[model samples]
Target chain A: MGIKRDISHTVWSVRGNAVMDVVTRSLEPLIAALRAAGYTVVGPTVKDRAIRLTEISSAAELPDGTGDVQEPGNYRLTERDDGMVFGYAASPDSAKRFTQPPRQTLIRSRGQVIEEVEPEAPRIALLGLRACDLAAIAVQDRVFLGGRHPDPAYRRRREALFLIAVNCAVPGGTCFCVSMGTGPKATAGFDLALTELAAPHRFLIETGSERGARIVAAIPHQAATGDDVAAADEVSRTAAGRMGRTVDTEGVQEWLPAAHDHPRWDDVASRCLACTNCTMACPTCFCSTVEDVTDLSGDVAERSERWDSCFTLDFSEVGGSPVRGSQRGRYRQWLTHKFATWYDQFGTSGCVGCGRCITWCPTGIDVTEELSAIRYGTEGPSCIR
Target chain B: MDARQTGRRPRLAVWKFASCDGCQLTLLDCEDELLSIAAEMEIAYFLEASSAPGPGPYDLSLVEGSITTPEDAERIRHVRRVSRRLVTIGACATAGGIQALRDFADVREFTSVVYARPEYIATLERSTPISANVPVDFELRGCPIDKRQLLEVITAFLADRRPVVPGHSVCVECKARGNVCVLVAHGTPCLGPVTQAGCGALCPAYNRGCYGCFGPAETTNSGALNAKLRALGMSDPDLVRVYRTFNATEEPFRRASEEAEGDA
Candidate 1:
């Protein structure tokens, strides 16, 4: 597939104009150009104590020189010494909300008249997407777009997206993309990838797609040199080094099934509030339930689809009973599926190794820790290797 | 007969066992989907939806809940005999549900906690999966199975092809949604790493941790997650409590709980 090609060495650097600096300066021009080209620019901006992807008319609206410090049940913003743009990672709100909104009108029916809701094509220029976010998008592509019954709305929106991926200059406390092999650098799946060079006000721009090439050509920037490439490489390496967490996925698929009868589930389940923040914060979760609403007249109604969590009792309602009645059953179902059985179904590990679940969980239940307990018996130390 | 080609409705029956009856409700919760599903299949026996139950050699039997009683065990045998194809739905039927918590504790003690007359309660020592006693054609994952996937399974079963329910972790769903890394963002405990991929990664999206409503994935390294939990400050008792949740009687969770209990 054209989607999976490696663009690791496709480095096209612009001299004197570091990618981040140029991105900051050219925000207005980029937005203007995209708008003129029939694209709506949406990127991360400070909102409700977190950086969220919202409509941006210019670069000034972006979160500049601000990064978030994340810990269990804690998230705070700190000012950066350097006035750098696109310095932070993904926000609490995932790009999935744009592609697969929390709630969507599927269809409307009135008496014998029936009409299907057609989603208007949205040409989106998503700015400052992290490599993990890009990997997440790829995962979603396999889910909604690659399935037998492709989600028309998701497919249309995805096809119209203009992605601007950025290599992480500074990793957050919870980031573990290095272990997941999803981030620190924008390896692929972007129209354009930007690497921020420190000293100079220039950017190292590399085009991953033809669309990226055109965008780079239109933007005002100088050609990048070997030094610029080295600077970008250093920035990526630093980001990778800063990751506070790691999960060894080596033979992970084989490991989970073998540990099926292991004794670690109970320990974790005890503290799990079953609030399901992890799934909500995850970048690749796509499970949802449909709802129908009718007016007082009871003649007109609309069917809507909304995001749902597996932690809830209603998520697995079958006959009149819940399959997983106890919190333990629910937790077991989730863990086993993520590590072991997913390979049987998707032919790929379901996890992209984003640490959203670890950070957002109210109880600080680390999946990596739980796996270690199961792999290395209870009497031993925490880390297996 | 080709149900799709000949327009002949496939006979469908819904069954239940020892559970909270939440999983079965997923079918009813599929309100709009249910109407369409009904149009495609003949509701041979669904006591929950209709009081008028029909006797049948059902083409497909969707069994929910779990067998926690001797009678239930015997009844499942009859159900398996009558149904051409039997699919276990929900965590209870596929993997003993919350009621299976009794498996660890004394049933008499449990009866004393809730019921006034311990003698009136007729229950088994442990709640077991349907597969333990009868052959199951398919086992849909989830505390309550994902309704969209549930519908897909039914559609595929009718179509006579393997259903495409991905057996990955909740983490996969989380990533696909582009959700911020919760573990990284909050350092909160979560089951997304080892949890199955269903419910569309809802808990994490809602700013909460995964509780593992879906059962174990194709392969799970729960031990690794347990070590992570300990490093995060979870006690052995805490670990035991975590495993003794819904589907606690399931082999993987059961073993994990026992280990935690042993340490405790």
Candidate 2:
């Protein structure tokens, strides 16, 4: 519904606004463009030793001159000498936090009369969001927007968003966007896409929407040469080369379920804390539960929807007992649904290969590693044990 | 009259045996929902709230803390007889509590270690759950039960339906809250995998590992967790000490602690 259908990655010239041609807008002006349009811009900010999406009014808030190092269960943000802006991988906070918050008040009731609670849909310009996260948001859209019962709340916040995608320049130690076919370069599903021309202190911006073009027109940007586009491609190519891990995308949907009986489940389960870190960190995991709270005077009662996890026993309680009574069973359900059954439900794979689960797991249980083990492990390992 | 026009509410009582009163405080902490609870049910015997005690035949009774003395043992039996529906709340009632550390060491030795007059004190050899002596209809996990969950438990009974407390690991809650794992990333030894879901994955969100306040989840893989802990440099003594914390005597942790110390 924004910037009327312009082709993906189409390079456009920023024309003069009401005044003269104000050629060449910098990173800070680009952020100002979003803020001027009554959009609250949010992007990766260095906070608490990690890059997280926080409210930003200018380019100074972005993790400039700082990059993060991530490995199996380890994440640390470090200072960079070259002062390169947008020189980092995905942060723990994503579009899901802003789109579907941890807690949402669903309904407030007083006996028979009940008032519905609508999600707060603020006009937000999301800057520096990565390619995998764009795909992850699409997956969320499928769950909340492309469903039979469209969640009004998710739909509201989602519609109010002005998505700005960033092509990956430096893949983290755990990133594998190449294998998932989700990133390293921006493909689709964004209003504006930016590629940081390596070490040049400049971003080659491409408009994917009319709103993006209008913003560019209102502000100022120099006409790009063919070398700028070529440089953008080269930058993305380098990022693709730097991927540390790879997801076996060769019919993962089929093999994951077919190998459901494989013993690797037990192998992973032993080291697996069943803490559900993977699901929580996942941009697409959308399970939630309803809580009914009555005020102290018993006059007003409220029903709130909170994020729920399949790993919890309370999630599958039936006839006074949880159906997934074991950690092994719960983990199997989570993985199988994410990798296998998700295709049947959403017409796509659930994982975008962002590597959050691996980086965040207390025991550092890697899903890709587990998948490989399941596909190639020896015979007869029971999850029940 | 549906108690709409009438002020009389359903009789409810809160009982404590041998705990820190953290669980009872959790109820008083429900400042917003307290009025709703008061409107629906009569506060028949919450010493934490009111001083006066009401007579028995209460509709519901919430018993906290573990049974520690002979008086506690007999008193709970009487409470069971009087209350129609009795639910045990928090670690102490559900599992034995931090005091259950006495389960590992000698109680007589403990008495001599602290008490001025060992002969004057009266105590049980083991700090046991309320269910050990009397029948408890439902058990809620957590050192101090989560308030919203407590509200759900009370309201569910009022509506005559089963409670919606899940028994999955703290991992799920961790994901729900979007907390990055402290254990995997920082090599912080955590019990989130085997610990039951609740507390909204609080510790992990704060960049710290879970201390297992809610006891073990439904099916705990202590063997695997132990192996990982060993790799992380936890000695035999560390393993024993880890399990012998808040819910020390809870079977899964107790058994794991016993196994860890059995060799050391």
Candidate 3:
């Protein structure tokens, strides 16, 4: 949708939100402003032939004409004729990498002297978080911050974040944010949000927080008319219709717990490599295990926490042997936990429906297909629940 | 712990059997930490480093290479008797190495083809891991073995604790390091799904599929991975060949390769 209506009435207020518009070329100034605001600006960039989140100093680094073709167990960077800045659906790794790092040192010891390492949280402005990513971050916040003893490192990183979200104009082949009610549009959990319109090559910006308002006031922008907002709405509306995959989340949060013996577990277990790809790629999978490492000399030692997956045999280790020893048990644990038990633990489903697990799986095992296999006796041809 | 607290360093001995001495060189490659490791333990009998031989009854023995000869088969039992704790290093010692390919074929046929005098050569029909001949405390899984993991195993044994070697797949390390899935993204037939994490997901980081140098992970569905590999244009022969590499004799790899060969 293009801004086709009359724009002589410069600022037609839409639902009491101060909306503005800026051409694509002005994103450089926004990047400069974020850098000037004492935040390390991280965004999606073309790295290692994929859309990877990395530190960027200029808006020129954004994947301008590059989009990604993502399918189950496959991802490829492609050239888009539309030249959309945020054309890609999701990155390989999400903002979770920035907030909850893969590994963190908890304590250090030399002989009898012990030292607890303080968490370091540098201010970061994440520039291109999608709606599903924001949902994933919210899920993580509940896990790491809403608990009795909040994770200090995760809390510090959470507080230090300045999120800039973007509405998805195009959905990838494995995306199911529409089914999860988490995407196609940025609803909340962002300082600022943008809907990139292609024809005129401009951004329809919506302020979500006071910090966003402050940044908007600092940057040069024109008032967005009702037509511009409608076009932006249309972009998300079209995206909502074009989801490549969908999970039947109807009673999944309740049903999956009982689906423990649903024969689908064995079917999936047969295909599941137990390689921990799904858990690792999942944005909201917050399980971790601590390891104590010592140097060649017996004097120095350190305890560090690294991301662990239920797919690992040691993850469920209790006494001498693993509780979930079989791939069948591990697979069941991971799927059931993500879809069902996560609500019991955190009052929210762990999956945000970004489909990273599907795209990153080496065997192209689609979660939607597995769920459908459980719900219906077959991988559904037309199931969108 | 007793060795250090009692004012005496534990004796560390390095032994070789049938294959290349690359695993031993990994110890010397630790130029920065070699001196520090030497300080912690007495380098009692490392033939590669020092010609000066120390007597048996060592505290820890780092054994490399596979048991391929009659003498090697007998020597391992003696080594096991002498050493308090025996740790096998590299694929050769832990899984019979590349030489274990002979386990699938006739060793006499190989000997007759290679050796000028086949009668003079005394060999075992199957090149097997040290564990097949004698007990092993820990087995460090890698082609040549990672030096850091080697050190960890050494120190952990000395300090009376379990080593921190994980049984998880290489995908864990690959994801932790933020390396994109080469198998998924590029349709490469990777053994990373079955291979254990040790080399820090080195192959995938460089945009290449893992050849399973560290052997099959604790949990692996190689049948499923082989199915995917087949979908990615890998032939049955290709599957057979890929699984028969560094960790060829690992049970899962051996079985999968045999299955692929059957299919071929």
Candidate 4:
């Protein structure tokens, strides 16, 4: 017996020589197939001077040979010699935007006629999703769908989606998914995981779901060999090794609460703009509040929920008094919750270590640096294994 | 006036001014207390809570943020009209917030540094507290007001009584918590002596000096703190930065900061 079959799906790998041709050739066919199946094909494309997820009809629309340089409040485009279409790291916009839009209408009412609006189920095939984003989706699933009060709208949108995950070959300046134990390779929660090996123009496809297996079987592909598996493993390792940042999460939950009053918060808060760009770019930040508006005529009324951040002074308002009255307190609350309290609440770190917050912030406030300050300030016993 | 016998719950309204919508979020953080509060009070105008906002002659109004623009100034007055007992929450509403850093410098310089088109920005030269513009019934201090205190205030309002909020210094809380004083022990420049009590003296417990997010305590001796800060080798600029925190505009702190900078 060579290898036991795990399921109905076949594990296939393409020769390095045939990788690019297979990818280019399959791109249009996959889009056409998805479109014909009444699904919108959404993938990475150059938009607003950066590679962002957009609707794609063909491979020509893909962000070919473009990589993104991300820093706090600064992002620029860089060209790559390799014609890899999905060569870049994650963009400022996460898949959460599509799943949980910035503002969503909850209910509408007009006099006695109160109508509850259910969001229309949109069938979307997300192409070239990075591993960090996949983990972010999992974090969101825990927040919106797995919570005690499941959001009916988010559940509907999530149920009607197909995920195509891509193994990141080049990590961005801000990426630290390896430290978060969430990325560099697509391990699960995907319909299909594609590793692009362009020499022979083929994508090494691994099916994660039943639907993915069906899609793989429909496509023209070859069975995996020992050499192909080794190459795939090597590429994943390289991607993991490329991460520029690492967060020491060892006993962070236990340490942060103990070091709550550390002077480090004062140092960090002084520089923080508190503009809330970090929370906006953060994929796991689920804090939101509802807003109601009546038309000028007062006949038609609508309620909408929009994203809110803890950094804002009004976020903690109560009978004419704010609890966290200083930028220091607010900044401390956000960081501690993400690194420490989140583990107490969710059994995991709130941050996925995407580094988007670090890069997109106007002031370049790094969470890792702040955490380091706490680690050094205290005299507690070390927990790093 | 039994609430149930009256057949009309006290109307509650939430208002926002010129700040990020963070302090308002603290109310929503009271997830367990919220539904119960809703059961007791009729939420008339919480834009962040419900879409159907009833016209307000609210018994209680929770106001957040500061007056930073001309529009905010007018809007706050309108809020005061609708609210019978208007309470200003957070540092911004009470002490002009971190945005009040604009008060120390030329607004044009700050705007040029932050925005590409400074002309497009419609901001007052200085951020001012809601009390400066309207008759505030109460002022709650904090960068983000504590959720528990918020609940207490709401419960007190429902009962037609004054809210139980401590006005002592952070030093009192630090002593109550039995934490070693970071300032005395480590020679750290702590503001716990002059800052308002709240946050349960969190910074001192973490082995850091308090940065005075809760603003001024009643009869705060900032002059004494400034002398101590100078003794601890802090520069005049550093002292200015310290006084100009969450409640920099408050009288004692403002006067002390001016004296420290030799402007008095």
Query: In DockQ terms, which candidate is top?
Result: 3
Put down candidate 3 lDDT per residue, A230-257, tens digits, no spaces.
Answer: 8988999999998999878889877778
DockQ of each: 0.06, 0.45, 0.83, 0.03
In candidate 1, what are the lDDT values of residues A1-385, reduced to their tens digit?
Answer: 1233223223344333344323333556666776777888998888645787888888789888888776544566778878777777556665677677767789998876788999755788888888888888877777776647877788777767788877888776667788778888888777777776666554576676665666666767766556677888899988887886666667767777777566566666676656566777777777787766543233456778867767655578788567776666777777767666766766555666666676676556777667666666655454212
lDDT at residue A296 of model 1 (Cα atoms)? 24
For model 3 the local lDDT of residue A101 reads: 90
True contacts kept of each: 0.09, 0.52, 0.88, 0.00
User: What lDDT score belongs to each candidate, Candidate 1 first?
Assistant: 0.73, 0.79, 0.86, 0.74
Report how far off residue A334 is in candidate 4 (Å). Answer: 1.1
- What's the TM-score of every candidate structure? 0.60, 0.88, 0.95, 0.59
lDDT of 2 by residue, A1-385 (tens): 3333222233233222222222243678888888888899988887656787878987878888998888767777778877777788878777888788888888898877898876688989888889998888888878876757877777667767888888888888778778888988877677778887654567777776567767777666786666777777899998998887886758778888887677777777677666566777888899888877664445567888877778666678798788987667778888888888999999888888888877776566777777766775534232110
lDDT of 1 at A286: 74
Q: How far is B261's C-alpha from truth in model 4 (Å)? A: 18
Model 2 gets an lDDT of 0.79
Q: How many clashing residue pairs appear in each of the predictions shown? A: 166, 18, 2, 47
Classified by CAPRI criteria, candidate 3 counts as high
User: Please, what are the lDDT tens digits per residue for candidate 4 over residues A216-248?
Assistant: 656666676666666767888998988867778
Error of 3 at B262 (Å): 0.9
* Candidate 2 vs 4: which has more TM-score: 2
